[model samples]
Target: MASRWMWASQTIILLGAVFVLAGCEEQTNSAQETESAAVVSTPSVLASAGPVKTAEPQTPSMEQLVERYKGLELIDAHNHDASDSRYQSQLGLWKQTGLGRTVLFGDVSEPSAVGTDAVAWEAYLKYPDRVIPYFSGFDLHDPGCLQVIRGNLEKGYFGLGEIAVASTNSPVVSKVAWKANDPMDGYLPQIYDLIAEYNAPILIHLDPVGGEPLAKLEQALEEHPDTIFIFGHINAYNSPQETERLMAKHPNLYGDFFAGFTLYNPDGGGKAEPFLPVLKKYADRFMLSTDSGYGITEVRAIEAMYRVLDQLGDPVVQKNIAHDNLMKLLQAQPATQTQLKELRKQGAGGAGTEAAPQKLSKLEAGRLLAQAPKG
Candidate 1:
């Protein structure tokens, strides 16, 4: 009996030891499995995270950009026909580039004033809704040129210029430069007053040379508070600080940022970023233009203008710069019969009627005649 009891106790002890070992091994396996799961889950959690950051930002598609600007009418406030042959070609380009309207004018640098004037007029007449023609036939040096300007205004012409009032440095377009005769100069003051009476805007290209030219510009703006003076190209070379100062001081003063020249000029190309603050600050006082200078192709000019507009960022500011500000200037009623009659009585130099070019294609004559005042 003693021997049987001893054997049974030994067997029980052995069995208990084996069970304890198996439980320890199972616990160890469970811990290892848990740690392995945690390691795998770390990367899985990261993989579920949305969109990895890219080194460069994605550019919006042209369709997306067009959608952004859908409600706004894009106007090119500074455009020209330097050569008499450029009007039709310009219109076609303007259409392709999505220009709603253009502030059209002839080039004073071009030798044939009449041909330039006629071409611009023909363009305006052909596409009355699209072309806002400004008279640029007169020489800035000749005070007598105002007479022709006044006569044109009387004969249903819009306003004056792209007038190279003080372009000492421009090799391409500023062939004829006007000197600023002190703060208030010769015919300009009169021209300003005359245009103001007619509720017209005058686009002037006064290269902000030294202190003197800018001073003259400020003085002119100060002297005629009612007159709208659009300083072409934000004066190209003027610093943003100076541009802001000028804009802040004068309500009558406005600027057109010449995108093409700024982008393409190797010697003085400027970035849109620097001027963005001032542009946003004086949003209503600035506009976008394709001055079409420096041999920049039409496609290039249009793209540069849009690039500037895109950098502007704010849709409201873009709209204002693109078209609203210029449209406000253009909204003034056409010279009333009374205004035209008064101009005639003044007997401003050119003929009672602006003389159309003797050689006109049937299409050209029809367009001009269609726009003529109905007697």
Candidate 2:
């Protein structure tokens, strides 16, 4: 009986050991399967994925900028296309770029080229609404220049300009040297007096760097407060503080803020930010321009002008600087009819002369000139 009981116990114990070993083997196989699955899945997922991406900021486009600025009713207060060949193209540019008006003048750099005044007249005649014509052809030194100016003003020229009185540094700009012994020297007072009588603006390019030029400018401003002097490029190198002081001192002394000179001049060595305070402070006393001289394209220069509007940021101020300020001067009293009749009788028909100068259209002349090789 004892032997039978012991055999039963041994069989039960062997059965229990077999069950435990089978369970261990199944767990080990499950773990191996899991390990194999991870090894295959990890690389497959990584291989399917590409380089990680990150979000980046964007800048406003030129088109977007144009759209924003198009509503400002901009006036180009100082612009020159001395060669009449580009009048049509200029009109188109002004239209496309949203320029409401332009103060147009001829090149005064060369003696012979001064007849470009005819070009200015032609443009004014063709698009009088768009152009505010200014006579700049006569020599400033000529004592007879006052009469010539009177003759043109009598014939209905808007103002005088781009009269480079102190341009001496730049070789390209100083092609024909023009310096004032001082701003008030020579026949300037007479010219100023005539301009005052006509109640028109005279755009002067006086580089008042030294004490004398500025002092003389102040003297002129004090002497003829009625003569509206639109200082071109705001005397290019003058500081904002100086500009503010001058503006405060002389209400008749306005500024032509040449955007290209401020923003694109390689030698300017400054940014637009510095001038903002003075610009905003004297918003009504300032007007924006695209001098169009700095080897910059018209479109680019116009863009710079718009940029000044954006920087100014106040709609009313922008409107004043862009259009109304200059318009006020433009809409002011012009030469009297009495003055006109006498001047006309003196053969001072000016732009209204019988034989208007001949001119080639841009498509005909400009393209060929552009295609000609550079010197």
Per TM-score, the best of the predicted structures is 2
Clashes of each: 0, 0
Q: Pick the candidate with the highest lDDT.
A: 2
TM-scores for all predictions = 0.71, 0.71
lDDT of 1 by residue, 122-230 (tens): 6665566677777666654577767877777655556676665665555544344343333355578888888887677787766544567777878888889989888
TM-score, cand. 2 vs. native: 0.71
Regions of candidate 1 where Cα sits further than 4 Å from its true position:
1-57, 61-70, 109-111, 140-143, 172-183, 268-270, 338-375
In candidate 2, what are the lDDT values of residues 170-223, reduced to their tens digit? 444444543355677668888899888868888876654557777888888899
lDDT for 338 (candidate 1):
36
